[model samples]
Target: MASATNTKIVSSPLLVLLLFSLYTSSAEETGTTLTSSTEEKNVFVLDNYGARGDGEHDDTQALAKAWNAACSSSRPASSLLVPKGNTYLLKPVTLSGPCKSSITFNVKGTLLAPPSRSDWTQDTIRHWIMFQGVSDLTVTGGGTVDGNGEIWWKNSCKTNEALPCTEAPTALTFHQCDNLKVDNLRILNSQQIHLSVEDCANVRVSRLSITAPGTSPNTDGIHVTRSTDVQVRDCAIKTGDDCLSIEDGTRNLHVTKVVCGPGHGISIGSLGDDDSRAEVSGVTIDSVQLYGTTNGARIKTWQGGSGYAKDIVFQNIVMDNVQNPIIIDQSYCDSAKPCEDQESSAVEISNIVFKNIRGTTASKDAIKLSCSQNAPCSDIALENIELKLEGGDGDPESTCQNAKWRKSGNVVPSPCKGSN
Candidate 1:
């Protein structure tokens, strides 16, 4: 489970009635029914509420006020317009709702974050902008959200250990939301992760461009946890960490038509951390392009952790100069301190399929399955895979330890000899 953040939930019955009256009056005057004109007159403009989009003033309060007005409006649907051609400077804020109606947050301008690390304190929430408990929400606009994360990136332990390590804020976070649609947004240079969807269901994300420097610490492009029926398509992501990460409790996730590079490739797990239970199932990745990544496709779990990962598929992938093109490491450890050698991981992995994967690997060991001895990986299948080292003379090799798999049709470098 992820850490909880403070949310400010507000509603006003009198305000709702007033807005409803105003909406109805406007619709009647315009000779349109309330059903057809609900979205037209229900726009709450931030500029009218004293939001000067000059990129210098803090507009957090102004945005919050606009959110409250829209959320409390009694219309069937309301729009919160962030108009184009201006830059709105903002601080950490949460827009929470068990709203009376659905909302559309139309972002058409730039939202800029503080430039200096000293501007943010540790007690601040780990998110710059958070949407919580909202259903039927659509956040779509051709705009940019700039985190200005250079200072935070410099202070990170991944860059320099002389500075004290602290948590940086995610650029955008959606928590406990359902029926969400996010499209055509550019999220760039976040202090931590770019976009996070946690405990959300029935989500569709597309046409998003998420980018950060390859050396940035912990800057995953999209991280989903405890979510279901999530579909991410037509996204171009370049980040330091995994382009897409599926954490525990996520199911029925489909990712397709993605272009990823200069990052750690798509991954599942590094789960079972601190002896915790982690489970993820029913994930599919198809038609992805990975270039110059640390790892192409991977599943990693730590020792002394219990749970199961099953029914996963990776097909129709194209890798270009990637390291560890295909891998599963049961003894996955990311900390600087050495981990104690354990006999096995308690997590069970089964029913994984990798098919039609064509790639060029930078490492000689292009395919590696290092599973736990006690709980070996079972029911794994590989088909039509062709991986070769980029500039090496020798053929790429497959390394397997306590992994059982079946192969069919055109496998390159051949399967390991000790398969059961």
Candidate 2:
């Protein structure tokens, strides 16, 4: 009996390693971690921090506690895990961080937002989930963030003009972060913009699936503002508004391998609103497909604004039944009526290149460039363009005004009979 007991205890190295892993997993499951003196605890589980994950119970406090512990850990790197197989209901929360080290928020489960506006406090009316002031962070783990925004959509002023127009909360926002990586997330039914990147730098966002109904109001897939050196790629976005909107103060932004449908196509503004100044430069949008979208590769600015949008390239794009395939509307007005014509201080748009663009336009005018009279667009280049009307009617036409453009290669609809 003594010999048999010793044999069982003295197993092979493989068995010993397996036993150790089992023990560690058991400790994690029970939330029994070793002391920091013995071993650094780097993984903070939401369930261990008292999140029931029942989809009904509020998990806000538990999430906050877990984040705090992970953010304050003395380890070189820490991870906060929202484990799989559970749906956590979270109220409005801002996960602010100036972490002790690099942090990773791994969402392997579902994060469900509150069902209605009544659950939002006055201070929390603008955002549902936010991460701010974090650097060297990575957010991934192939999970779902369900905004549950049906109630908010019903109350939208666009849906019901009788209701007072108010701001709906964005689903996920990252503000003032640097060296961030966000990927492999499915965001559904956002209240407003699905993901907003503001004042961030060196960010990479990819492999995201963001979806809302075509009629859902103001649900932009991704909105970037005041961010630098950001890359957005491999995203499939379908929403009521622009698939991607690059606002003012954005520089060196690159977007590729994107699929957009049932929404407004990628836009470089409705910038310079309220007579404010806007500046955007060095933006390249390539390898994009727009299906049944309202517009394609568009730039829209208000009439009475100052600043410049330049050095932009839209290349290798394909549009299917798009209403406005290629457009530059400097007189864009979203107000209830036509904007009061104030052309005194318009935003300067220049050096815009539309290259290798082939598409089928849903409208008779395939290309419309209506630039500001005071600040007309210059150095607009169109190369290798072939756009035809949907259903093979007569060839599409081009409309141009106050635009100085140059064309090369096979530019169909023949470019409005003007040259550089």
User: Which candidate number maximizes TM-score?
Assistant: 2
Model 2: runs farther than 4 Å from truth? Answer: 1-41, 418-420
Flag clash pairs in model 1: none
Clashing pairs in 2: none
C-alpha TM-scores of all predictions = 0.89, 0.90
lDDT of 1: 0.84
180-217 in candidate 2: lDDT tens per residue? 99987889999999999999999999878788999999
Give candidate 1's error at residue 255 in angstroms. Answer: 0.4
List lDDT for all candidates, in order: 0.84, 0.87
Residue 358 miss distance in model 1 (angstroms): 0.3
Q: Which candidate's lDDT is highest?
A: 2
